[model samples]
Target: MRLVTYRATVEAEARLGVLVDGTVVDVARIGARAGVPLPSRMLDFIRLGPVAVTELGHLIEEAKGRWPVDGALPLPSVILLAPIPRPEKNVFGIGLNYIDHVAESSRALDTSPELPKQPVIFSKPPTTVIAPGDPIVHRADITQQLDWEVELGAIIGTRAQRVSREEALAYVFGYTTLIDMSARDCRRAGQWIYSKGQDSYCPMGPCIVTADEIPDPQTLDLWLTVNGVEKQRNNTSHMLFKVDELIADISQGITLDPGDIIATGTPEGVGAGRDPQEFLSPGDVIEAEVVGIGKLRHPIVAG
Candidate 1:
């Protein structure tokens, strides 16, 4: 099931939806009309766990390919927000999880070429998130090296700590496409919070495909493009530390609660990794995708 958080208008409250036949079936409306209970927000819905997912699935199946189910709206008639537009906590991130990306960073950014012995973890503040079609702010005053990294974002459905790699996938609620917008030159003393955590730096979602629909997260193909030209492309198979390993490692002690997102590191082809280097400027456009999940397109706008 492809679940989303959307709004009929800019001023309307965001509501949970199920995307089917190119139309958004309002989950809460369907539940209310069907005499069932369902939450209107993505985060609250996620906290309900499998039971909520099961109920929503039944609602969709019962629709029988119906268009405009009561309260439903055409996809283009609504605004699609990030699956979790305002997360409860900072987004967890992994850096250089792709071997090829590690090599490219070494060439273009003069970073180490050797692969990390463990997952390189980082965080992006909640303010960094924006919905699909939003502008990715280019903070020229702060730094000129604005860049893009397309990543796979995993949304956690349940609390997990000290989870084994084998059981890590069980904790995932679903997946979405996340663009890791970065200010390449903002790195200071080896920290990335400022470089990658600025407002509008994390453009996520078209929708989240439920975990049951994608049993193997590592088999998806992901890529990023700028102004219609491809800059990055790689299968999740090339990930040095796969999703399960990341979940297990990151959850070793820190608790991963419902609605928390982990952005699995991007593969090579970022602007900073290009020959002679490249960067985004106002008016430029970026489209990042994790096939099977969805794609996110954001225009580069001045900060």
Candidate 2:
């Protein structure tokens, strides 16, 4: 099932929902109808552990048995928000984890292409998140070298600590599309937090496709388009360090909670790697996706 966080009414707070057949079914309402308990927020729901997800699945089936669910709303009628709009912690990011991305970035930086010995990681503050159809502010006066990186976001299901690569996949709850919006000109060798964590820099979600639905996370295709022009395209299979490794590596040092978003590094084809280089400007529309998850389209607007 594709889980979503959406707002149906203008003044309503975002609510947990499940997308089915272009419709958004209110999870709370359905849970009530099926005599199950569900939280209104994705993070809270996820914290309930796998049993809760299993129960929600059962509830969904129960609701389906009734058909024409009373709480079901047309998906387009609601505003979709990040699967977990305000993650409990900074979003974990991987840098230079794609073989081709490494080469492209190395060339753009005028350096030799040598893969990092371990996973390259960074963090994006919670304020950087924006949902689908929202605007990615283009701070024109500040940085001119804006770039896009489309990545697969893995949402943790249960608390993870010192997990091994073999057992890491079990900690994932679902997957979502993430655009690791960056400011290339802001780079200063050792400084990345500011360049990658600016407000509205992380645009995630159309819906979080439950991990079970994706047989193998690394086999999914992901891509990005600027306006109508396709720019970045690659499969997760190309990632140098797969999702399980990243999770296992990160968890060894820090505890990962439910709803934590780990944006697996992006593949090649970014604007910064172009022959003459390119950057985003106001009025640009970016459509990014990870197949089987969903698509996220947002506009770039001047601040």
Candidate 3:
């Protein structure tokens, strides 16, 4: 089931719902009536584990009876927000997973960085997250080389530590689309924290697709386009470290709790790797898509 979080009205707070047949079934309301106690927020659902998700699925099915009703629950599109807005922890990201991205970035740096003797990990602060259709803040003064990266974000379902690659995928809740907006200059300063941690830099989600929906994570096609021009186009099959390996590697020493997001890295065609370089400016539109998951589209605005 595809789950979403949205605001039904300007005055109403954002609430979790299930996306079905182009309508959102409010899970909280349905759960209350059905005598199932489920959290109204997506993060809470993640924290509740697979049992809660199963209950939510049942609630969604029951809630389907109420949709298209006149003046009852408001139409879903009236005020939609980010599905998993404000995650508890920084969005974990891996660099140079795609062979093309590795090659291009290496060439741009005039040095071939070793293909991660280990998973080169970094964090994008939670504040940087925005939802699909939200505005991406382009800090023109601080960064003249703003770039876009289309990445596959994996959402953790269960808490795990020191998991093996064979069992890594079992801990996943589902998948979503993420745009890892970057400031190239800030990144080149040596530390990636500040460069990656700008408000509205991480735009993710339309909805989270349960792991069962996607049979093969590695075979999916992922792409990104800027202002109607295809800038990044590649399949997940090119990833140097696959999803299972990434999860196992990341969880080796640190515990991966529920709702923790790990972006599996991006493919090629980033602006920073271009000839003479291309960068994002106000009014630029970015759309990132992954098969089986969904698309994330946002416009660039002055910070």
Q: What is the C-alpha local distance difference test score of each model? A: 0.91, 0.89, 0.83
What's model 2's lDDT at 144? 96
TM-score-sorted candidate list, best first: 1, 2, 3
Structural similarity to truth (TM-score) of each candidate:
0.97, 0.97, 0.94
**Candidate 3 global lDDT:** 0.83
Could you say which candidate leads in lDDT?
A: 1
Clashing pairs in 3: none
lDDT of 3 by residue, 1-303 (tens): 888878777798888877777767777777777777777889888888778878777666666656434212544455666668888888898988887888888978553656767777999999988977889988878988889999998999999899999999999998988899888887655778788888998888888988878757898898999999999989999999999999999899889999999989998899988897888999999888997788888999997
- Write model 1 residue lDDT over 1-303, tens digit each, in one string: 999999999899999999988989888888887788888999999999999999888877886466345578989999999989899999998999999999999998767889999999999999999999988888789989999999999999999999999999999999999998888899989999999899998999999999999999889999888899999999998999999999999889799999999999999888888888899999999998899889888899887
Model 2, residue 195: what's the lDDT?
Answer: 87
Ten-residue stretch with the least lDDT total in model 3:
67-76
How far off is model 1, as Cα RMSD? 1.2
Q: What lDDT does candidate 1 reach at residue 201?
A: 88
Backbone collisions counted per model: 0, 0, 0
Error of 1 at 58 (Å): 1.1
Model 3 has a clash total of 0
Cα lDDT of model 2 by residue, 34-103, tens digit: 6676888898888898888789888777667454455788887998888888887999999999999899
